[model samples]
Target: MADIVGSMRVFVRVVETGSFTAVAKENDVTAAQISRAVTALEEQLHAALLHRTTRHLSLTEAGSRFYERAKAILADLDAATDEARNASVSPAGKLRLHCAPGLAQSTVAAALVGYQRDYPDVTVELKIEQSMPNLVEDGYDVSLISATQLPDSIYVAQALGSAWSVMVASPDYVKRNGMPLTYDDLATHTLLKLETPVSPPDEWHLQSTDDAHVLPLTHAPLQVNAPDVMRAMLLNGAGIGTLATYSAVEDLAAGTLVRVLPQYRVRPFTVFAVYPSRRYLEAKVRTLLDHLRATLTPALEAVGERVEAMTNTIGEAAGQAAKSA
Candidate 1:
């Protein structure tokens, strides 16, 4: 039993640090001791775990699967230890999270500030990325993302909120070039294009309280790939661009930019908080999810309110302009 526990710990450490020598140094043990312990573990289980070479050690396919399960078990073991030490205490451990770039910057980042403040014992790490990572394989505790498709696998997901992709232009562009009063008017202005694999090509679908329309913005003179950079260009008065509502919250509130049709906005994109299922939940992951759910609710509300308000203001101004003309 002691050998099993010791080998498991060494295996987990090696996976995390990617080096047997590092694990040995940290535990004050010899590399041979580590190897023998792992071999004993494999022999007991009757399964080969590692494919080792002269210079490197990598997990076999079975070993890769085992490592995930083993890490979760070790975490639960630690939690059990803590509970035994202090029965009344709440969870405390390290949590790793994955998120998209826009959501990470505008929403998750803010929530984490309060989460850290509320739970000093819980350590949180964020992996901000554009690519959707394999949560179980990568060992992420939770992932906050916006996507329509999800893997129908052994994972559970919770819907957090929704976001919309909308058209926005700088105030300077509106003044110098001209505001687009209708769908047809958009053709006359420079449509600063955002190129992303997720969105439909040269097509934007927007809806108002009463009507819906599709505009093909393929006639754009300029196109950029990065959402952040495109938003930056729009804010700096370079041209009109479209992006998710969360990314443009601060600028919209300050009136540096404006929405085109006050009555119309795009259909909302869905957001989710996803994680792997475990028999026993760890304290760090539970606390982190709780904080995320609590803190991000207000952020979604604030961004939605701003969009609605901007829509109204633009509608009113357009109406008055027609009357004066």
Candidate 2:
């Protein structure tokens, strides 16, 4: 049998353009090919779909009825094809995003701001939860998580970046207790601890070139579950607290909080954009993932650079003081 859809398309084009040659040229097919397609369509339908003369071509009474139906079929097919293509490329509709709590206040929010500006059609519903959500069961398009390790699952985890824990104190606390030059120095300082369900409470893990140190905050003055609370406390000069780079970048940049022990850093936790594994990833999810990778990675790197610079400055001052003494 002749391709009914292809023939219908050609027949509709022939009727609309009113010239076989015009349809052929427009479709980049030979006029003979266009004529053959219409002939095949008419033979299959058992009716003449067009009346032809030397000067012009017109549709017969039966042709007019067939033309309307064929035109509608072609239009519907075009609309369906366009809808599929748009779904593949264009990011529209609602994207339900479940993100880690502290991330939204950091680069995640900034990345999303830029994402929204670029894709005005996409509606992003962001939920901040401490726990990771089941992407398939919860109907979340994406989940942003911070963890030392992600559990084995069917979900695909794309690393946005890593967030290293940095020990920071307010200028007031530093001025009062002086800067901690050694790991042991932290013992004398009032340590503000963060007690998260994901990590152990009242313990700061530090790593340097030669040794690994775990500072037990047995008598920590304040302990909080949320990073923002810990950051607020640190900003208020409550004590020295270890915080994720994402949570402390702004304060570190403004010199409100200074990084301590630049040479030693805690275990760097990774931030992942998690989504359900699929043969074809949705455009909205893919676009947001790309945006996060582009924006969040650089932001985290900048935080690292600023923290390194601060560490170097502190180290230089300590060196100069030793020489003078």
Compose the digit string of candidate 1's lDDT tens values, residues 43-101: 88789998888888899888899899999998999998977554224655667899887
CA lDDT, every model vs. true structure = 0.78, 0.84
- TM per prediction: 0.68, 0.72
Cα error, residue 302 of model 2, in Å, equals 2.0
Give the count of colliding residue pairs in each prediction: 1, 0
- For candidate 2, the per-residue lDDT at 71 reads 81
Best by lDDT: 2
Tens digit of lDDT per residue, candidate 2, span 177-207? Answer: 8988888888898987787534577677788
Error of 2 at 229 (Å): 0.8
lDDT of 2: 0.84
| Model 1: lDDT of residue 218 | 68
